[model samples]
Target: MRALARLAVTTLLVAAPLTAVTAAASAVADPTPITVLTSDFEDGTVQGWAGRSAETLAPSTTVAHGGTGSLSVSGRTATWQGPSLDVLDTFVKGTAYTISVWVRTASGSDNARLSVERRTGGVAAYDQVAGNTAVTSGGWTNLTGRYTLATDVEFLRIYVETASTTGAFFIDDVTASYVPALPIQTDIPSVKDVVTEFPVGAAITGAETVTEHGQLLAKHFASVTPGNALKWDATEPSENTFTYTQADPLIAWAKAHGTAVRGHTLVWHNQTPAWVFLGADGQPMTATAEDKELLLGRLENHIRNVAGHYGDDIGVWDVVNEVIDESQADGMRRSTWFTVTGLDYIRTAFRVAREVLPAATLCINDYNTNVAAKRDALFALVSQLRTEGVPVDCVGHQMHINVSWPSVADTRAMLQKFVPLGVEQQITEMDVSIYTGSGESFPAPPADRLLQQAYVYRDMFALFREFAGEITSVTLWGLADDNTWLDTFPVTRKDAPLLFDTVLQAKSAYWGVVDPSKIEQTPPGTSGCAVTYRVTGSWTGGFQGEVKVANTGTTAWTGWTLTWAFTGGQTVTQLWNGTVAQSGTAVTVTNTSWNGAVAGGGSATAGFLGSWTGGNPAPTAFTVNGTACTVL
Candidate 1:
C-alpha cells in the first residue's frame, strides 16, 4: 500500500457554456469557507478538464471575474456538451450547498442553467439539481442558487445556455460550499469484481510444491493467470513450434478449484525465441521491411494459435507487456518489438488477438504509470490504437511499486486520466519492495522491514477502495516472502514483499483484510469503560493493542468481558471479539476472524458496550455502518 502525496493544485473551476450572473453582495469579511462543491463551467482553463465539449475559455466579468476565467460555447441552445470540468473532489449526501457564479447573456432569451450530478461508483453520472434563469444583455449580473444535497450527487456541473446565435456570455466567480453535517455512512467494499489470470494447466517449477502453493493462493485469490510459462520461449521453444505440456498442471488445478485463469502474455520483448529475431541464415536482420514482415507473421501465428487453443477458457490475455518505462525520458522503451516492427506491433497485437479470441479480454500491460511521462506514453499509445480501429479492451498497470516511490495520489491521478479512454484497468503483479540500497546482500529481515511492509499494505488497500469500480483486479506477485522474486532479482537478496511472513504466518498485511481484536473480549474485573488503544504492534495484516481503562470508578467486578461494537457497513467474516475463558488474571482473547489475531500483552486492557448509528465527533470511534458504539 502507498501513501498519497498532497496535490499542489487545490482549487479547481469547471465551467459550462451559459449566461454570466452577478450579485452585489460584498465579499465575506472572513475568508469565505466556500467549498466549490461542483461547478458546471465557471473557472479553470479548458485543458484542465476531461470529456468532449465544444467550449472555449473566454474573459468574463459579472461576479468580479476571479483571476480572469470564463467559458464560451458556440451557437449555444441548451445543448449539453458533457461537463466543462469532469472531475470533482468531495461530494457527500444529505447536506445543503450554495452554487454561485457571475453570468450575463447578449440577449434576454439566453438562459443560464446550473446542475449538480452524481457519478455512479465513480464512473458515470446522473443530474441532481438543474437551476436555470433567463439572462439579459446588460452588465455583469450576479446569480446564486442553493440546493439541498442529494444522496446521489458525487460530481458537479454548470452549463449556460444562450439563445443568441452569435454573441457570447461571460461567467466568473463561482463557488459552492456545504453547511457542515454529520459524516454520512459510506459503505465502500474492499473487493471489486474478481479476475482470473493463471489458467488451468499452467506450470509452476520455481520453488516449493505446486499443490501446496496453489492451495495457499486459492485461499485468498479468486483466480490465477499463467505466471510466465506462456511467454515466447516457454510456449514456443522454436519458430513454428508450440507446446502446452508445462502449462497443463497449473491449468488443471485451477479448473479443479473453480478458479479463473488468464493468459500470461502473447507478445513481449524479453524471453522471445531466437528464430523470430534472426533471418534465414541465422543472423539478426538489418533491413526494417524484412524484420517488420517477420515480426508481424510471428505475432499473427502466435496469437491465432495460442488464443485459439484456450478459446473462451482463459479470461484475459496480456497481448503486449512493459511497453512504457518511467525512466525512459522521452517515451516508450525501444524494445525488440519496437526496434523491428516499430509502433505497428501494438496495433497488430490487439488486432490479431481480436481476430482469434474475439471474446477474450486483451490488455496492454506496463509499469511505473505513477510517473507522468510513462503514463502520457501509455495514454497516447492506447488512444492511437482506439483511433486506428484496434480492439484493445483494457490497460494493465503492473504495480511493481517500491517502498518510497510512486505515492498513492500519483497512482490515483494516473487512473483518473485513463477513465475517459473508456477501457478497464488492472493492477497486475503488485509487489512493494523496501529499498535497502542496490547490490546490498539479502539478510534475515529485521522487525522494521516487516512493520514497513504492513504499513504499505494498509495504505494501498485504503486507496484501492476509492477506485474499485474501474480497477478489474489486483494480483500479488508472489505468495510468500521466500517465494517472492524481490530477493532474487535486480541485484538479488532483498527482503520479503508479500502478505505472508517467511514462516508462512499471516502478517499485518493480512490483518488489514480482517482484524481479530475487533471481535475479542476482555476478562472480568477489567475496567469497563471507553478506552483508547494504541496499535502497539502488528504482523502482516494483524495488530496488537494496549487499551487502558481510566478506571472511572463507577463499578468493579471479579469477572468481566470486554465488549466492543461494530457498525453494519462492513461485515465481519470472522471474530475473536468476545470473552475468552483463560487461566491467570490476564486472559487473551484470540481473534477468530478468518486468518487474523491480536498480539498478547500489546496494550492495556479496557472494556466497553452499547452501539448506535450516529453521534458527535469522536476521532477514535471505530465506525462501521454510520454507527458509533459507546464503551460502557
Candidate 2:
C-alpha cells in the first residue's frame, strides 16, 4: 500500500530501508549467465527496435560501432523517448540480466543509458540497466549495467536513451543475458517464531497468495496486509459498482492458513478514483456545502461497502493513510478529500468502519512518524480525534527506514511520545533500505551495505521489543527484495530491503532479527560513541575522506563534537553535512542543523575533500562530545 507519498518523506530524510529462487539449489553460489538476446545491427534491419513515444528509429549507415550500420534515434522531446525493444517474451523473472550497449551522440556530448520498462497492471516502471556516462559525437562508449526482472509483468521492454539531451543519438551492440540467483534454504526458522513478542507480517498482492511466494509467506508470517487490493481504486473503481477479484484470493489464503489479516487503507489520498471528489456537474468539487456533502456521502458509501464486505475477517484497518503533512502549518495533507469535507472525512471513515466491523482495530497511519515534528503533529491529531470520541484505536508508523538513519532512540521516542495518549501502536510498513540518497543506483546489493542493513534491523528490532506493550505488531512492506516498491520509487534502482533475497532465501537481515549472532560484524560499544574513518579516494596530493560517528549509548546527543588527530599530515580543505575546524594535526568537527542529533544505534556521516602529503593514513583514535569513542 506504500505509494509515492512516503517516498517524499524518505528522500528528504536521506534514508529508508527481492525475488525468490528455485528449490533444487540448496546453497549460495555465484549467478550463472545465459545469453538471451543480441543485436549488432549488422544485418541493416531495424530488428524490432522502435522509438518510444514520439521519437523516430532508423538504421544509420554512416555511424556504426561494430559493423556497417547502427540504429539512430532522433526527434526526441524527452529524456525517456528513445529506441525500445520488447523483452517480455524472452526475459525470465527472478533472474538477473547484464545489458550492454554502445552509444555515440550525433552532435554534442550526452549521457546514454540502458533501461528496462515494465508495464504491470497498467502502471509503467523504468529500471536502469546501464549507462549514465557522457558520450560525444565521434567516439563510441560502451555502457553496461545489470538488472533482475521482477515477477508478474504484463509487458516489458529494454530501451536506450540519453539522460537529458533531446538531440539525436546512435546505439549499437545491444545485448541481454540471464543470471541465475542463489538458491533459498527451506530448513530455516520461521521469522514469526523468532519475534515472539508480537505478530510478524507482510504486505502482499495476489501474486504472494500462490506458488513459492505463498508458501514462504504462510511459513514465516503470522499476519498479512493486502498491499493494494483493499484500497478504494482496486475494490470499487466506479460508483455503486464493486469488485473483489484481486482481494478475495489473498484474504481467503490467509484465512485458510489461520493467519490474521490487516485491511490496508479504507481511505487514502492517492490511488482513489477522481469521481469521489467530483460534483453533480461532473467537474472537480470545491469547498461549497453541496460539494462537501457529496464528498462525505461518497466516502461513507465507499467505506460501508468495502469494510462491510470483509467484516471480522480483517482484524485491523488503516482508517486514514498518509493524511499528515508536517510541512503544513496545520499538519494536514491538503488532499481533495480534506479540501472538501475538512476532518469529517477521517471521522466518517473510522466511524463507519467501526460500525461495519465493531471488533476490528481502526488506526490512523502516516509515514516519517519517527521524525519529532511529524510524530508530534500526528500525536496532536490523534489526541484531538480520540478526545472528541472518534473511534480511533491505534497509531500506525510506516517505519520505512534506511540503513543509515533515525537511530533506535528516535524510533523509541516515536513510540514513547504516543504512550501518554494510551493508544496502541504498530510498525505498519517496515523495510530497511540499503541506499541512503537519491543519487545512488546499484545494479545489485553491495555486501558491506547489506551488513549495515542487518545492523539496522537488529538495532530497530531490539527497540521494538523494548516497547512490546505499546507496539502490538510489526509488518514488513514486502516479503522479499524481488517484489519491493523501492525498485521504482525515489529512483529507478534495485534495493534489498526485506528478510529474504530475490530467490526466496533468508538473508543476513533475517538472521539479524531472528538471531544476531549469525551476523559476522563486531558488536557496537556499550557506551559513548563509535567512530569509523575511511579514505574514500586519493590522488597525487589530494584525497576524499568519510567519517561516520555512531552514538553507542542509550542517550541521544542533541549536539556532538568529534575530535581526532591525523597521523599522516592531512588538511581538510572542505567538508559537507557537518562543520570542520583544523589546527595542524588536531581536527574538530561539529554537526550541522539537519544531522546534529545522533541516537544510539543511529549514525551521522560527514564527508570532506582534503590535501595529504606523502601517504595518507586513517586516524586511530577519536572522541565525540569529549568522550573517547571505539575506533572502528
Candidate 3:
C-alpha cells in the first residue's frame, strides 16, 4: 500500500547525524544474577553453543566483548548461519529475557545478529525476536535485546545468524535471563488532541491488512495522505488512462471519516509514467520546441485532470517533489522534466495546479531540507519561483530525522528561515529515525535514546507550536513502527521512527510531545481497577504484553480508563485494537465505547510491545474511573 519508489535521500546527501555512542567493549547487565539460566562463555569451550547452518564453530581467545573466550565461526557466507541453541526446557516461559553478544568481523564489514524464537504448529509456526548491531573491521560491538515468551515452546532456537555477505566472526559474553520490565508513565494526553494549530496526520497505504493501524489513524489523525495511490503511477498506470481504483477508496473513506485528504505529488521525478516523458517515437524528449511543448502540455493536463477532479477535496497538493538535488554544487537534480522544459517546468506545474484548485494549498515538497546546504538550495528555488509570480502556497520539509542529528533546534531554524518567503511550512513526511547514521543498524536504541527521541519530538512540536503562525500542518510519514519505509532505505535495518510502536502502542516519545512533565515516573500497580498483566512474548530488545481489565467491584464501570506506570524504561510500541498512551512511567489504557462497559465481574484486554533496559517489571497498580483497584 505504501509507495516503494520515493527518492532515496541518504544516498545522495550523506549527512552523518551526531552519534555519541561507543563501540568499545562493555559489560553486559545481568538482571537476574541470582538465577542465571545461561553461561556467558568466559570458559574456552563450545559446550552450550551450536550452529544450525554449515559452519565450523570453536572457542577463540582472539576477541570478546566482556570476558576471555568467544564463539568463533568460519567458512560461513550466509548472514543467517551463525549460532543456535535450544531453549525449550532450559528457559522459563512468560518472562522477559535478553541476549547480549559482543561480536566482530574477521574480514567482513559486520554480519552477525542474535535471534531467539519458538516454533508452534501450523499458522503459528516459527516466531522469534531478532536484534543486531554493526561491527567494524577491527572493533568489537555489544548488541542486546529483550523479548517475552508466551508458551512452553518445545523447540526454541537461540542463534546468531549472519547475512548473505558474511565471513568468519567471533561472538562472546552472551547472557539470557529474565529482566524485569519497568513500569511506564501513562497519565499524559494524546499529541493529536493537544496540538490544534495544525492538523496532525500520517501517510497510510492499505491499512486494511492491519486492523490496529487503521484504528490508530481514525482516532489520532485528522488528515490522510495516500502514500502511493495518489501518485501519478498508481492513479494513471497507463498513458491517458486514469484509474482512481487505488485512490478513490481513500478519498471516499476520508470524506466519510471527517478526515481531510492531502493529494500527494501531482508532479514528481519518480513514480511518473514513462510515457509522460517519452516522445511519439518512444524515445527521450528532444530539445526541440515540440518536445518542450509536449512535456509541458502533459504536465498541465495531468494537473487539471487530478487537481481539478478532486478540487477542494484535496486540501493541499504536492505540486512538485524532490526538484532540488544536493549532489550537484547548485543543488538542482538533472531530470527529464528539467532537461526538456528548463526551470519553467516547476513554475508551470504550480500554475496549472493553482488554476484548478485556487483555494487549495499548493506545496512544493522535497526530502533532506533539514541539512543547511540543501535547505539553502531549496529556499533559493522557492524564492526564485515566488519572485516570478508562481502560485506556490507552501514549502514541505520531509523531516525524516535521526535521534542524534538534525537536532530539533536546527530543524526549527530551517522552518523559520522559510517564514520570510510568505509561504507556510509543513513537515510533510516526518518520521524520526533511531539508526546511529553509520548506514548500519546499531543495537535497538536503548531506553535513554528512546527518551532522547521523545525530547527531540517535544522540541520539534514546541518549535511547531511556537511557529503556529507559519506552520500549517505536521504529518508523520507513517503511524506505526511496521508501516514505515525507514527499514528499507540506504541501509536495511529495523528502526523505530514513529510515535507508535510496531505493536500499535504509543511510546514515551508520544508523551514528550503531549505533556512531558506531570507524568509520574513510577511503575504500575493496582489502584482502583482489577488489572492483570500477562507476558505474551519477549526477545532481543523488545517484548509483547497483554493487560486484562476487570471491574471486580459492585458497580458496573462505564467509559472506563485504566492507568498504570512502569518502573524500568520499558515502552509500549504497539497496542492492539485499543487506545493507549504513556507519560513517564504511567500507562493509561482506555477502551472504545463498545468495550468500555465492564460488568461487576467482566473484563477487557489490550496487548502491546515494549522495549526495556535492565529489567521488565509488570505494573503493580491500576486505576479505573479514578478508583484504585484492590489487587495491588
Candidate 4:
C-alpha cells in the first residue's frame, strides 16, 4: 500500500539577494518584474520548505550552491515526494511570474523538474514551469522558466522533483518574481469585421466580463457561447428544479454588449447530474421500458425549462452534443441516454428544443468530424433522424484540431460531405493545439509551433470563407489561452491554442484570421529528436514509466530504434507499444509494426513497468536510429 503525508515547515521573514533578469519582448510589452521570493538557505534553516508527499526535509551543511548551505530533501518513495513551497498568497491572478531554483543530486544524476500544483473549481492541475533539466552531484543546475497564473485559484504550491529517482537532492537560491501583463493593441482590426457571411464568436466565462478581457471580447467577437454555465449539472441539480445563476450573468453581459448568444447545449454525455440517471428506487436505471420512458420524460422537461428560460436570447442551440462514436457498432455513443432510450433520446432532444425555441437553429454537435469514420457516422445519424422528420437543422463540427494534423483536404471533405445533405454547418469549439500528441508537453508554447498554428488558423479560416453560403457560424473554444479547458484535459500542462495570449493581447493566430500577411512562415523543426521520460506512477520497489520519442525534424521518420543507458540497476520486466532489448545497463527499443511511422513534430510513446535497486537515477542521454536525441 502507498502512504500520503505533507511536511510541516515554518516561513522565514528575512529576504535574500535578488537576481535581475530581462523579460522577452512580444506583441505587448511587459513591465519589469519585481522580486517576491529570495531564499538562499544561508539562515541555516529549512524555512518555507516542505515535502510535497511523504518525505524528510532538513537543512544540510554538506553542499552549497551559494553561501554556506542548502535545503536537503530525502527519504522519498515517489517521484512527487520532494520539497515544495506554498505560494498561495505570493501569486497574483492575471499576472505572469518567472521562477528560478538550483538543484543537484546528492550522489547520482537525475532529470529534475520545477512545477506548480494549482486547484481551480476543485480540480487539481499541474503545470511544468521549466523543461526537465539533467542534474548531477558534480555541480549545481539552474531550473528557470516563466509561468502565467491566468485565473485565481483556491490553492497554489510550487515544487521541485525528479522523474522517477528516489534519491536525495539539494535545493538553493530559489526565487519567484512577478511580471505584469502587457497592454493589448486597440488599433488592430476587429476579427469579425473580416468575415461577412457568418458570425465570428468565442466561448467565455465570468472572468472575461471585466478588465481588458471584457474590452477585447466585446471588440473582436460578434457572438458568444458560455463555456460550462448552461450544462445540466449547473442549471438543474435536483428533480423539477432549475436555476440559471451561472448562465444568467453571461447572457446578460452578451445582451448588454449586443453580442449574440449561442445556447450550448440541451443534452450531452458529460457534465450531467448523476440523479438524472437514477430511478425512483435510488439506483441506476437499466434498459427497461419503464426506465426509457422516465429518462425521456426528464430530458423533455429539462429542455422545456432550460431552453424556454433562455427564450430568444440565444438564437442557436446545440440540441445534442457528442453523440456519435465511430468505434461503436451502431454509430452511437453508449451514454446513459443512449443505453436507456437508444435513438429516441436524440429524437426527443431536437423535437423538444424545436418546440420550445421554434425559430432557433437546432444543431447536433460532435468532435473530430474531420476524420472520415466519425464524420460518416455523424452523417448517417443526422440523415436518418432528419429523414424521420426530426428538426436537425444544422450539423456542428467541433474542429478541435492540432497544428500538424487534419490537412486542408480532409477539412474540405468534411464540409463538402455534409453539403450534399443540405444541412447548415457550423464550426463549433475550434482550437489548434501546438503539440501533435498527448504525450508531448511544453513549459511554454514554442515559437515554431505558434507559427505553424497561425498558418493553420489562416488556412482553416480561408476554407470556411470558401463555404460561406453553407456554413453559418464559427466559434473558438476559448477567447484566449488564459483559461482554456485544454490546460487540464488529456494531461496537465500549459497549452496556448487560442487567438489571444494569456495577457489578453492578440497573437499571430488573431492575425491569421484577420490578415494573413502578418503571419510569418514557420521554420521547420531542427534535424534531431527530443525524448521525454516521465514516471506515470510509483510504489515501494517498482514503478511505471513512459518515454515519448518526438520527431523534432523536418522530415518524417519511419522504422527507428531508440537506445539509452541507465545509471541505476533498473530492469524493464514488462513493456508495451514497442519491442525492448536489455543488456546490463544498456537498453534498446524498436517501434512496433503499427507505430513505426512518425510525422515531423509528432510523437509516439512507449511505457514500461520496472524494478530497481540502490537508486533509480534517470538516464541522461538517448539516441534515435543512431542520431543523438536531446533529453527533455
Candidate 5:
C-alpha cells in the first residue's frame, strides 16, 4: 500500500523516558497498568546495551517496523546470551516496568524471552521478570514482560534475549517503561446486537472459556462456536463409544446464557477417526461394495447419533468440510468418504445431518473462497447440490484472509454467486491475519497499514449489512489472538488476527466494524450528487472498474452514498477507495474517509477489481444520496 501523505515516514528518534512515552493499546491487552517505553530504534545504533557472548547490534534493512533501520542479532543459542539494556540508571529503580521487543526468526526458536533483572553489582541479585514465550518461527512476534524492581537491587537490566536453537533472530522496537491503566472498555455493538436477524459469534478457547469474567462477556455475543470441543475426535474417539462430555458443558453454558450454538462439523476429512474408514477386521477397507456399505454405515451412524443428540438445539451444522479439491479436475476432494461414495458422499452427509437436525441449517464449509478458481469449483459443487434439491441450506465461506490479498470485492463476488441459488451465506471461521510476507511486517504493523486493516473490517461489516437478509451469521474464528490457529498451521508465528488481544480487550478492528463514525467517514446526508460507473480494466473472464461521484447540488455534499445494479451476471471481486456492498443485483458504494466529502461540483472516485462470467454490462442506473444521476 502506498503511504498516505498524512502518515509519511519519519526520520526522527524516539526517547526512552517514561514521561515521553505514549500509551498505545495492544490487540488484546489494554494499556499496561504502568507507563510503557515506546522505542522505534531509529538512532542507527544500539548504544547503552550489553549482552552475553560476542554481541553484534547493527542496523538491518530486511526486517523493520518503520523506516529502513532495525537491529539484527544472530547466533544466540546459550541460555543467557541476548542483547540487554540497562534501564535502571535513567529510569526510577524499583518501579514497575514492562519491556517489549519485536523479534523474528526464519525457522522459529525456543526458550526465547524478555526479562527484567535487578543486580547489586555485576552479579545479578535476582530476576525481576521473565517470559515463557519462544521466538515464533517464520514471522515477527512481540515479546513483552512486566516487572517491578526488587528493593535489594541497585541496577536493572532489560533483556531482549533468546535461548532458542533456531540459529538467527532479528529484533526491533525495544523499550521498557512504567505501565499505566488503559481507559475502561465499554461494550461496543456486536454483530448479534446490531444484526438482530442473525447470530454474531466467537469461538471459545482458553482465553474466552467460561469463567466469572467470561460469563459476564456473554452479553457481548449472541452465539458461540466451540473452537475444538465439538470436533469428531473430541466427541467420539472410540468407534462405538460416542462422548458428549466435552461439548455438554459448552451446550449447557450457551443455553443458560441464551447463546445459540453453531455445531461445527458432523463430518470432516481432517478430524475423523481412522477406525471409521477401516474394516471391521481392523484393517484398511478394500474399495468393494461391502466395504463401502460399512463405511457409509459408520458415517451415517455417527451423524444420526451426534446430530440426533443435539436435535433442535444446534442452530446450524457444517455437514461437510473442504469437500472440493481445486487440484482435481472434477473439483471433489478424494477423502475417505469420497473414496467410498464418490460424488454421492457430499449429498449423503448433508442428507443424514438434515434427517437428524431437520430444523437446523446444514451447510458445506470450505476455505479460500476468495480465490477465483477455488470459488468457481466450490460454487459449482454447492450450486449443483442446490439444483438437485439437496438438503444443503447454506454455503459457508471460511474467509481466513490476509491484510493484502483476496480483496473484499472478491469475497462479495463469491458470496453473491450463491444468492442466485437461493441458499443463505455465512462467513464462518473468519479472521484477518496481518501480512508478514515479503511486503508487510507485523508485531504491530505500520499505522497506515493498520488503518488499512481497520478499513477492511469496517467494510466487511458494511458488506454484511448490505447482504443481511442473505447472510444468516458471521462468526469470528477466535476470541483473542493468543490462541489463534495461525500460531501453528502454515507456520509457527506470532500474530494478531482476531478483534481482541490477549487480554480480551477489543482492538481497532472491532471499532472499525461496529462504529462507522469511529473511522474516517464523510459527514452523513449528502444530497444531489451525480455518479458514473466505468470499466477501468478487463480480461476475458474478469474486469476492473471504478465509480466517480460528484456533488451536483448547490451546496457542498458530505457523506454521500451511491447505489446501482448489475443486470448482467457481472460480479466484483475486489475494491478500493470506498466501501462497496451488494445485495442481490443491487450494489451500494459508500465513501471512505478520504473520499467521503465532495465540495460543490467537486468529484471523487473509487476503484474495484472484479470477475464475471456471461456478461459485463455497465450498470445503467446510478443514484447518489437517493437522487438519480446522469451516467456521464
Candidate 6:
C-alpha cells in the first residue's frame, strides 16, 4: 500500500528567551530540504523510486505532492538512508524550534525508525530527541517533534533505519522553523483549460439504424462519417471507372464545421468491386496474373485519387485498416490486399498517400489491441515499418471496449508498451456497449453501466493525463447512443458508450469531462428548481445574504412577508452559512453561521446558480421587511 503523511508545527512564545549567545555567534540553521535516502534506487522519477533487496545503496525519496526521486548506497547488505537535514552546524540554548516532514512506505515491510538526534562535541556520539512507531500504510502520515536547544549540543541528524530488508520509502515537503504552525493547502485540482477549435475528425453512418440521438451527437463531435464511404463497390462499380458521389455529403458537412475528415479506407477485401476480381479476358484474379495487376492498379489509383481530393483538409487517412490477425504469417491479416498485392500493398498504399496528401497523418488502425497476441503482432508490423522507413505517424487503437472485456490496467499497460515506438497513440472509435438478454456476458444494467462508464472514462482520462505528452487526443466513435454503431453491429441492441443519452440528455459520463463533485449547482429554471430551492434554503456557508418580501398592496390577507434580493451576480447554489424560510409574499433568509451570507439586510437571497455568461442584471426593485425599498 502507498501512503502519505504530513506533520505541521505551530508555536506561541511562552516567555521571553534568555540571551545566552554573543552577537554574531548564532549558528547557521539546517539548509537542506527534507530528503529521503535509501538503497534500491532506480531513476530520478517517482515511478523509478523502488526497492529490491539484493542490491545495496539505493532507496527512494518522494518530492513534494507525492512526486518521488531516489538515493542509494553500495555494500554487501545494503543500508537505505534518508535525512531531513544532511548537516546542522550550530545551537543556542532556550530557543524553541519545530521540525516536520511527510513520510510513507510505498511498497514492502514497514518496520523502520524515523530518528532525530543531537551530536555532542565533535565525535562523542549522539542523543535521541524523539521517535515514534505509530505509522499506517498506504496514506500520508504526519510525523512531528519539537525541542529546545541545549547549550552543549552542536549538530543534529535525522534518518530512517530499518531491520526488515525489503520495501520502499518516499518523503516529501520537509520544513523546519522557529514558529509552531504550518500552512495548509489542498491537492491541485485536475481541470484542464477547455479550448475551442476542433482538431481530428471522423464520420458515422447507420444513424437511422441506431435518429436525433445520432444527429445531436454529431453536432457536438468533431466530424461525421458516412460508413462504407469508400467500399470498393461504391467507389469503383466497374473495372476501369471510379466515382465519388456517395462520399460527398460527409466531406461537405465536415468542411462546413472546420473538421478534419478521415477517409475510412482505401483497400478492403469484403467490398471489392466485381470487375477488379476479374481480368479483361474474363478470368478471376485467383487464377491469372493479368487480373492481379489490374486489381493492384485499381487499388493504387483508388488510394491516390480519394486521398488526393481533400488534400490537407483531411487530417488522417486510415492507410491500412485491420491488417493483423492471430491466424496469419508475418503479422499480416488475411485480406485480398495481402492475397493479391501481397504484404507490399501496405507500403504501396502509404507511398501513394504520401504522393497525394503529403501532410495528412497516416495510420494503421486496428482492434483487439488489448489482446496480447494481437498487440504483439501490431508491434511487430509497426517495428518492421519503422525499420523500412515507412511513413506511419500514429497507431490508432480502436477501443471498442465492453464491460469485463479488457481490464483498465491491462489496457493502460498495453498502451505503455507502444510508447517506445515514438509515434503518437490515440484511442480512436471508443465505445462501451451493453446489449440486453446477452446474459452476464453483456454489460450491467443501465445504472451500473452508467457508473462503470464514468469510472472507466475517469481512469482512462487519468492515464491520458499521465501520458499527456505522448498522446495527442482521444476520439469517441459516436457522441450518443442514437448513432453508435454498436446497436446493429454484432447483433446486440446495447446502449452505446458516449457522453449523452438517447434524448440528448447529459449522462453521468458527461461528469467525466469535469469532476462531478465540483458541480454543486444546476442551471436555474429547469425542472425540480422549486424542490431544490426548499432544500438549498436550509443550508449555510461562510458568505451571507439577506431576504425581503413585498405585497405590493394589491393582494390582501397575507400571514407574513419577507423579501430581499442580492446585489451583483451572486448565485446561491448550495446554501451554506445561511438559513431561509418562505413567508407570504416574500422569502426571509438569514445567516445562521459565523460566516456572513452574501452581505446582510439590503442584499437579496438569490437561489439561481450564477455563471458569467456575458451578461449581468442589477436588482431594480426590492422589498425588505414588507416595506418597499429602493436601491440607495
Best by lDDT: 4
RMSD of each: 24.7, 11.8, 15.8, 13.0, 18.6, 28.2
Off by over 4 Å in 4: 1-29, 32-178, 521-632
RMSD of 2: 11.8
- Candidate 5 ranges beyond 4 A from true positions: 1-184, 212-217, 436-441, 520-632
Question: What lDDT would each prediction earn against the true structure?
Answer: 0.51, 0.77, 0.67, 0.78, 0.64, 0.48
Ranking by TM-score: 2, 4, 3, 5, 1, 6
Kindly list the per-residue Cα lDDT of model 6 for residues 1-632, writing each as its tens digit.
00000110111111011111011000112111211222222345332322223444344453232335444322324334433344344222433343444555555435444444455456332322223333334655544433343234466555554445534455553434332111111132212223122232333532211223224434455555444555556666775476665466456656765655666566655555666666666765653466567766777887766777667766776777788886676777766667766667788878888888877878877887888888889998898887898888888787777655668777877788799999887666676654323442221123445566766666666666677667665666654443345533444233446665533445566566546543222221111111101111111121112222212222332133234443433444333234555333233554344423222111222333222223223334444334544331
Backbone clash count for every predicted candidate, in the order shown: 67, 16, 63, 0, 16, 54
Clashes of 2: 16
Model 1, CA-based lDDT: 0.51
Q: CA lDDT of 596 in candidate 1?
A: 31
What value of lDDT does candidate 5 attain over all alpha carbons? 0.64
**Candidate 2 local lDDT, residue 570:** 89
Lowest lDDT 10-mer window, candidate 4?
1-10
Candidate 4 residue lDDT tens string, 1-632: 00000000011000011112221132123333456777778888897899987799999888997678899999999987899998889876644566779998999999888888877678575766654578999999877655555555798998998986989999997877654555567899998888777999997766566556678889889999887778887788788889786688789889999999988778988878999999878899999999999999999999999999999999999989999889998788898999999999999999998899999999999888989999999999999998999999999988888899999999999999999889999998899987788897654465578888999999999999999999999999777875566654555456788898765677788889989999864332244687766543344455556677778776898878999988878888888889999999999999999989987766777888788787666777788998787665
Candidate 1: stretches off by over 4 Å: 1-211, 326-330, 439-442, 515-632
Candidate 1 per-residue lDDT over residues 287-377, each given as its tens digit = 5787788778888898887888778777788898887765665467777777777778888888888888888888988877778888888
Ranking by lDDT: 4, 2, 3, 5, 1, 6
* Cα TM-score per model: 0.50, 0.66, 0.56, 0.63, 0.56, 0.48
lDDT of 2 by residue, 160-226 (tens): 8778889999999776654444434578889888899999999876546555667888889999988
Q: Highest TM-score: give the candidate number.
A: 2
| Candidate 1 vs. true structure, TM-score | 0.50
**Candidate 2 has what TM-score?**
0.66
Model 3 Cα lDDT, one tens digit per residue, 266-356: 8887888888888877898977789999889888888788777788888888889888877787778888888888887898998888888
Error in Å for residue 39 of model 4:
11
